[model samples]
Target: MTYWSGFCSLQKEVQPIELTKRQEMILQIVKDEGPITGEQIAEKLNLTRATLRPDLAILTMSGFLDARPRVGYFYAGKSGNQLLGEHVRKLSVKDYKSVPVVVKEETSVYDAICTMFLEDVGTLFVVKEGGILIGVVSRKDLLKSSMGNQDLQTIPVGVIMTRMPNIVRCTLEDSLSEAAAKLIRYQVDALPVVKEAENGGGLEVVGRITKTTITRAFVELGEEATV
Candidate 1:
């Protein structure tokens, strides 16, 4: 039997699922450049062919893609474009919350905690003396720091913060889908939303992007694009 047949057999034995990130990425790749082989898709994404086979199987079974004996996978029809477009649209950042809660790097940990409590937020973006995003502090970070012998009054917010490279951020133009993908892919609670400063320097955060924001936006839009 063929790949499609194999996938169908599996689906009959189990319920279908919405496409996952890896699956969605595979579909986008195939839809953009098809008549392509599984090996090719795996190579492009730095995935092993064995790892990608399951995703290809699900896509073919769901009718979003078709595989021939040798021609590889092709978009089954117009639904492919519509689905891809919707995915692209949802990923855009313009549709979601853009206001960020920020604190200076030198702010006391005690004061930061108060800010978090008053604002009812779990994380605080740390900005530099010049207003550039430099790091982030989560409630857990504060709790850990506060639990120790270090004095909260004397400790700078930067002392307990997760520094740059550890922090995740996105631009105002990024798609909600992309943000969600990063959140899951990186296993993080929130992303700092930043914009390039007019002076052409570092990122200036305009908002705090969270998974909740993406979920709410997705629900409001009511569009599902193959994961």
Candidate 2:
């Protein structure tokens, strides 16, 4: 994509990137040379291409340079901070929440464990017949239950899960920062993303936020910045 094309876009955003002096110099070199090859840039600066390859890679990946196969790299004229600020300040939970893993409130503890492992999730949201949020169960919750000889296959997860009116959750409107705090403040790894039920009933589980979700968001943001 062109450099100006990214100006109006957040590029999904990223944290401010700090550039070393040499990296800045390399960017300046590319700016002056215009659509120059990495070998030419390095040779012009009296350095081997191998010596400067990492800086070139960093510049291209962080939005300062654009590279094309066999065409070398060109200055993209984008700032790392400018690209990153948009995502952190403007993006909300709705963009990052993952599909929620849910099971019926009446589901057996054994079944919930199987579902958790099958879905590869850290936490499971227990819902009513209509997918209304009712409770939450984590790996720890299952482990505690499993440690005992209580009938896991017959015992309901609703009995061991953290019941509603107490579950830590976020709405679609909540910011990513707020979701991160909910994870930290509650000392939990995940939060059920919820929305208010019809009229004045209760929350309906919509999605989920987890450490993995945040990590994946940053990974994608970095990828977008590069593109």
Candidate 1 lands at a TM-score of 0.59
Which lDDT tens digits does candidate 1 get at residues 91-137? 56765855778899889999999999998888899997556888999
User: RMSD of each candidate?
Assistant: 14.1, 15.6
Q: What C-alpha lDDT values do all the predictions have?
A: 0.79, 0.83
| Model 1, position 101: C-alpha lDDT score | 83
Task: Kindly list the per-residue Cα lDDT of model 2 for residues 1-227, writing each as its tens digit.
Answer: 67777764655465579899999888887776655678889888899999998998888888889875544577676444633553454458998888999998789999999999899998999998667988999999999999867889998998899997999999899988789878999899999998888865788899999999878877876675566
Best by TM-score: 2
TM-score of each: 0.59, 0.62
Residue pairs whose backbone atoms clash in candidate 1 = 91-175, 91-176, 91-177, 92-175, 92-176, 93-174, 99-207, 100-207
lDDT at residue 119 of model 1 (Cα atoms): 88
